[model samples]
Target: MKTLWDYTIVLQPDNNGTFVAYVPAIDGCHAWGETPEAAQSELENVFEMIRDEYIEAGQALPDNVELVASHAR
Candidate 1:
């Protein structure tokens, strides 16, 4: 059985009140939804698609990473 990899995702609330999510390790991989939960669900789908593409192309997967949440005043 193949081991499942987990990637850290960053979720941020935009000015419009919607939530946006992205994987810090994957460039151009992101998704947005009205709620944080929805955003996270959409992001999960995006991650799977990107992973599949990488597998098909024989490309190395993005490195697993984590980002600390910080607020800017």
Candidate 2:
């Protein structure tokens, strides 16, 4: 089964010159890396985790969740 959910990844600079990614929809779900690519990779893992949790909790995942980039701001 394939399901989708609205997720946002915000990249912000950290003190160590690295970037940290924050997923707003999943509280406390964050990742940090030296590059944007790495940060995004981490975010993908976070997304999978959240998806699994939602399924286990019997929550229905959306058939298609459109992410509005503007709203992530």
Candidate 3:
């Protein structure tokens, strides 16, 4: 059986020429990179770690969570 986890990536400029990727849903799941693609790859790695931790702890994972991106003023 497989499940889907919703993730949102927000890019924020850092002090240097790099950017930081923030994943709010997952704790301690943030990554910094010189480009967006690199940040995304790092985020994937963080996500895998989170998933593994949950599985090892025998926790009940939630169903597919969809991330809805909307602009609100």
lDDT of 3: 0.69
- Regarding lDDT, does 1 or 3 come out ahead? 1
lDDT of 3 at 36: 79
TM-score of each model, in listed order = 0.80, 0.66, 0.67
TM-score-better candidate, 1 vs 3: 1
Global CA lDDT of candidate 1, please? Answer: 0.80
Model 3 C-alpha lDDT per residue in residues 13-49, reported as the tens digit of each score: 7899888886665567788889977877787787677
Q: Ten residues in a row with the worst lDDT in model 2?
A: 1-10
lDDT by candidate, in order shown? 0.80, 0.70, 0.69
**Model 1: per-residue Cα lDDT at residue 58:** 87
Residues 1-73 of candidate 1 have per-residue lDDT tens digits of 1112377778899789999998788897799999999988888788888878888998888677766768999
Tens-digit lDDT string for candidate 2 (1-73): 4422255457888899998987665665688889987987887787778779878999864443335655554
- Order the candidates by TM-score, highest first — what do you get? 1, 3, 2
Give the clashing residue pairs of candidate 2, or none: none
- Sum up the clashes in candidate 3: 0
